[model samples]
Target: MDNRKEILDELSGLSPRLRDLKAKGDGLTTPEGYFEGLSDQVWSRLKDSPKKETVVRPMRRLWRLPYKSGIAAALVLAAAALIWLNRPRESAAFDLGALTPQEAEQYILNNIEDFDLSMLVASRPEEIADPAGAGRTDTLDSELDQLLDEYLEDVDDATLEQILF
Candidate 1:
């Protein structure tokens, strides 16, 4: 209780000093008309000073030509690589020399439907035509058909089953 009463007495004592300080108005002063002519003085000073000229040199585009071309080439190569990577490539032609006779025969039999017999006959005009110059002959057609039937007849049941299934 005594501590509180002492604090209150101290604060009351400082109140009159604070009022006196406020009445004295901080005791600082500026030169007469200092602010009124400040802008004009700054403008006059700027006007009286010598102006500085700025010189700008033009950039040489030729200097960067190689670098720009190199970047463009790299971008083109990157695009080409991306296109190559994404495109669907055709399977390479079969290397006939690499296949055994049986393998070649089997491959031919498997893809027999892909061949056009009519086109083959048409291409080999002399082969099927009569040597006597007869326009065309049913005998050659019958012979070719018989040869194909005989060839198929020679194949075993297992080979035929494999080819079919």
Candidate 2:
């Protein structure tokens, strides 16, 4: 009538039934290494096979970087050198005909009071009746030619007249 005794009785009966079913199947017949000959045949076929040959070609040519940028740099440097070599040299010799700074300043200061630049600025361009006279035509022509040349040479007319008159 106790509950523990009832459960133990049911489990003890189930163990015999499981043993009887295992005995009826193939689990009761075989032992180890039943197929040893089949394994030997497979390994012998793999080891006795032919080895493959790999063909490697000797490198006939190697790839390299292009030389165009280096060539362009060298050409530019050579052109610059040629231009510098062919340039004209400035004159190094001296001449005494030019006025010095002190001399020019002194001359301007000494003659400033006697000249009137405003009168020349207001004067009109009147043509000489005859820019030539007896026996003085060549002189007049030469002077006139010099004057015309100076006028056409782009010299500042106002500054020139101020200095002259």
Candidate 3:
């Protein structure tokens, strides 16, 4: 409350001086009709000034040449890569005439498990016999013996024993 009273007293002391200053308004003043003629003055100045032409040239279209070619090259490379990656490889051809006796024997031995020996042996005799079954057993036996001898010539005793057993 005391602070409010002191503020009121100070404002009262300055009241007369504030009234005198207010009666003699600030000396700053604009010329008569300054605002009304501002737009017209600006227009007259602009009309008397010389005008300069502004020309805008179009940009060159060659800037994207390298980028376009690079994309085309990338696409071509990608296509080539895909074609190379997906191409079929030629399989190695097996030549019986080119194989050595040992190679042939090894191949036969390795693939022996693929044959069904029991089924072959159990086949009907009629299948083995020709239209005439009489007096042909000797010839067949001799041919079989010859073939067996030739096949067993290169085979070791142990392998033969294993096959026989």
Candidate 4:
């Protein structure tokens, strides 16, 4: 007990305010009705503080531009259409009806190599329906026919069917 008293005397000598607070039991005293008006004190301080200036940023532009390639394509198509509509008309100077049967045959014979035989046959379908099916063909048409005939004469029907079917 004497040792504890000596320690307390040393502490009191160091700080008189601490010794006085110890005598008073507790030094944490508040103003009257502090707890009752706590909410009002907080609100009053909040209202008195300086307000922040709001930033007024402008809205960014939308990416709603029309397609450049699409516009160019439309323009190109319009130009092509206009040119096609206003094109020069072909003259009927060389009438097909003015051609004689012999002259036409001579012209065809002269340019037989140039003409596509399949296209010719397709054009003259009525010529396909010959009397007795006796097809009148020139050297150009009969060349392949003659070769085929010689080939068939050599190969038997069974071999021909195997190759064909």
Candidate 5:
């Protein structure tokens, strides 16, 4: 009880200072006026703030800018394309005799003795003659010749040129 009474006395002694503080606080108690006063300052601060400006380059200028390393490649490709388009079209000519000088000619001109011509002849049949109903060996040889002729014809001109030339 006595401690409470002492606290009350101390509070009573602070009454005058409290009132002075309250009076000072009351001078700044305008709710609408405080915000209104700050409105112009806020807008002015915003208006004075720094702004970033962006610069855009022209498209044509960007296209016209020199490419660093690919200029040589582009020039080469363009030159090749121009030469290809403007070149005179000529039929392909071939003369195998003109390909190499005497050295290469000597390499291919030697006579070949490795080949055997006997295998090309027709084989002899078991019997000398077909007495009952046996077919002739000449018919089989003729058929083989026809087949070989047809096979040769099937070989394309380009393939033949590659082999011969």
Candidate 6:
């Protein structure tokens, strides 16, 4: 084809040596014994090179593992142990039952600002939920009123007004 001729002419113009090789119709060639001792030549170079040797400790790894893999496994085990050791335990749990009723009530009253009405109501028994059913509610209210009256009597007008306002 005309295209093939153009490519051939372009290649021949680029390299006259390529044109001569094309006429000869031969590619690369070597002498008859050029590769006869190729394996021996490679082995001679290998024999002159240095080799590395590594010593392994039997106690380093549980199984016969390589150095990097064994160290990774040991790190994972150490991390797991640390997490398990620091986790919360049932034996160290707070003993809610250990607190007596009076002690619990005193604690609640002392920290009353931390509690809301819903929380106090929910913690009370069903009978106490109805103030009419619990005589303690009336008694507590009267005691609180008496205490307030006694404190107000001791305070002068300005201090009482400041406290109220």
State TM-scores per candidate.
0.25, 0.18, 0.22, 0.24, 0.23, 0.24
Which candidate leads in lDDT? 1
42: Cα error in model 2, Å: 48
Best by TM-score: 1
Predicted candidate 1 versus true structure: per-residue lDDT over 72-125, tens digit per residue: 888899999999999984221233235565654554455555544464345446
Tens-digit lDDT track of model 5 for 1-165: 897567556656878576445435566456777877798998899899966665556654445547534666788999999999999842111222243534322322321122112222222233224543135455434544664465458768886576556
Number of clashing pairs per prediction, in order = 0, 0, 0, 0, 0, 0
Residues 1-165, model 4: lDDT tens digits: 897677569878898677656656665889999899999999999899977777545332222245556667888999999999899853222321254756545544444445445755444444456644436434325743454465567768897686656
Error of 3 at 72 (Å): 66
Task: Give the local distance difference test score of model 5.
Answer: 0.49
Give the per-residue lDDT digits (tens) of candidate 6, residues 22-135.
Answer: 666666699889788898998898898866566556665445545678778889999999999899853211321254656544554444345444444434454367767577
Error of 3 at 115 (Å): 9.8
Kindly report which residue stretches of model 4 are placed more than 4 angstroms away from their true locations once superposed: 1-98, 101-115, 130-134, 137-165
Worst 10 residues of 6 by lDDT: 90-99
In Å, residue 85's CA in model 2 sits off its true spot by 3.1
Q: Where does candidate 1 have its weakest 10-residue lDDT segment? A: 89-98
Clashing pairs in 3: none
Better of 2 and 3 by lDDT: 3
Q: For model 4, what is the C-alpha lDDT against the true structure?
A: 0.58
Model 1: runs farther than 4 Å from truth? Answer: 1-116, 126-137
Better of 1 and 6 by TM-score: 1
Q: What is the C-alpha lDDT of each candidate?
A: 0.61, 0.49, 0.59, 0.58, 0.49, 0.60
RMSD of 6: 17.0
